[model samples]
Target: MVRLEKDLLGEREVPATVYYGIHTMRALENFPLTEYKVSPVLIKAIALIKKTAAEVNFELGYLTKEKGQAIAQAADEILNGQWQDQFVVDALQGGAGTSTNMNVNEVLANRAIELLGGQKGNYSLVHPLNDVNMHQSTNDVYPTALRIAAIWLLKPLSEGCAALQEALQAKEAAFAGVIKVGRTEMQDAVPIMLGQEFSAYAGAIARDRWRLHKVEERLRQAALGGTAIGTGINANKKYIFMVNDRVRQYAGIGLARAENMIDVIQNADVFVEVSGLLKALAVNLGKISHDLRLLSSGPRAGLRELRLPERQAGSSIMPGKVNPIIPEAVNQTAFHIMASDMAITMAAQSGQLELNAFMPLIAHHLLGSLKILTNAVHILDEFCVQGLTADEEHCRNLLENSQVSVTALVPHIGYDLASKVARRASEENITIRAAALALAVLPAEKLDAILDPRAMTRPGIAGTPK
Candidate 1:
């Protein structure tokens, strides 16, 4: 039996097939450089797919021992990381991962042939399609590999979010008693503890984490047995169950059979759901980055309540300047994820009756979102959060200058008098205490008691209830 390369050559010499031929070797040369190049995530996914496929073929019971062994050997080489060099297809392409699947088949088949003491592409002995890809279709395999990939990504993403939550929780605990001005529409309206603000960011991330996990659960329903459509038309019934079970075991994921294989085959809602989760994460990160930029704005003019780490030099000419480069990077990543989301939305919407057929874009965008969010979260946590400091002096100055102090006066001086004092404080650039003193709305000692920003920040003890 001769390999595809040997058959194409017609002699012992290897043939120069198209850069990335329909087979695995072509996939390698064609996709020699790509962001979608094989990752451990893809390796594990392909391993699961191949293992499941082999189990299915075995259950079909049509092949002899040698043929089954050939398929198994090729899959083992992949699982053992021997063919890492061959998986080069760009995941961003529109082939719906057909080239990627074929890459796996060709490389594995060629490796299997070598193991069997034959030249590569020896289809008569062990064909890539006949022996290796016995009962699988790209439609089923692509989505299944996606689920496997998502499962791989979910662990670190969740853990990274948890780490961020912990960092925020620590910030909350660290700043719990430290009061600062809380602004509405960029104007101070009330007082809240610095810790409360950090805790709120953490809470937002926590909820997003729960939402993403729920999204991942929807990803568990795969279209593996659906083949070209929901019918599983050419596949053996025993093959379906065996492959499903084996893939589940091999991947260590709880991928159950789809109840409506037609719906699974036709729709790309699962990708949509995952994309939505990623968008949520990106939105949250954007908000967090925006807040960081705002909080760290000025050591002289703006609200300098919080200080992010000085990631890089702020200006080319300005010495003693540090910029929030990490937060800026976070913002950019969020924008990229948002753009990816638009692609996912379009792909999801463009699906025809039977199949979306735009899954390549879905995978590309969703996977890009996952990768970006993961790395951004890491940078935010490691460089930004780890070195963050609350500017106690800035917090004090903000609270001291805040007209929100007059919130306590609403109980003692009444709404009308308090509004007058607040207006005076704002228009005249005077402290609310001084404004109250000038207005004779309250005595100096009484005004101090009623308008203390610290008391207002504490809650439930700012003033007597009127």
Candidate 2:
């Protein structure tokens, strides 16, 4: 069945059963970009804003008690996960998310009217703009809702980071005693405990989680009372003062009103700052993944100091081949996140005058990066970091063969003799210990004690070289 709905652009027949109205219908027609619909979390954030506005308006005697009650009930239903499919507009629409804000207002209005025993589109009794959107503009409400949605979304990403950090720390403890040759510029530089490398990864993830948690401080300050352009034109002074408090109560988040509404409305630097933190996380994850790939490069020919879990058959034609698919997937996810950060940077800079017209793109990229990184962190923990196994024998062998092990003998035999020992090891293709003993650089017992890889990983002057 079809019902006619009119707007300034004219009337269109919308599906009778849908809660969304003509504004949403026009947006659907205008932005046929993809099958991507608005985020359900974003929709719920908008509904919470609408419900709070209704309560404030009713308390100020601008709305009837019955109208406000019905609107609040309808918003509660939306928050409890109903009528999600009725939000049909694309997420990437233009006009700074007016289409999205209007979509929420219309849906809440129609549903509230139905609850009040009136048919949908009966705006005379329970109007979408007149009652539900009282004192609200897309400029104020949309950015406010986006902030709430981002705070809501960051919880999962923070949890994912914590999980990944725990997994890496477990690996760190598991490999604490295994000594390996540490490389600089692809050459052996010194001996180090394998645990130290994993500890570094864990530290990076811990910092990322801390940054994610700190970001809420900036996101909590919103431009909700700014009306159309921070002037609070048509809204009541009481409503402006009380709305954010009510919103914080309804949403159960620490949302604060912006002290300077004009600056909040005109600038998107907070989002840029948040995206920069996300990019730093992506860079860390990418570096960790790359290091994992190199550490697990080969079983026979490359630096196979660690064994990654064999996830699947790695080749279409070759047999008995297992690849580091999990780390590879994480690498790709980080790349996507970095690119999304670039998009967010451009969108933030595109703001002009009183408001940014590029909010839809900003919303799309920011939320998308968060979602992907959350999943990436979870999979990296489950498929890669948790199941890592260090090749202890390989680590010992590499440490023994490394010419850089002569670095330990520098204090006893002097750097000049240590340099000659290293040169002889490389020239004669022998172990550093063998070259030192052949050159009589130190006594055999003294050389063994000084060149001990495990002792080298720690402190204390190599036991005075026996």
- Top model number, TM-score: 2
Specify the poorest-scoring 10-residue window by lDDT in model 2: 457-466
Instruction: Report how far off residue 319 is in candidate 2 (Å).
Output: 2.6
- Over 128-147, each residue of candidate 1 has an lDDT whose tens digit, in order, gives 77777777787788777877
RMSD (Cα, Å) of model 2: 1.8
Can you give the TM-score per candidate against the true fold?
Answer: 0.90, 0.95
Misplaced by over 4 Å in model 1 are 1-40, 458-461
lDDT of 2 by residue, 281-326 (tens): 9999999999999999987898999999889999998888888999
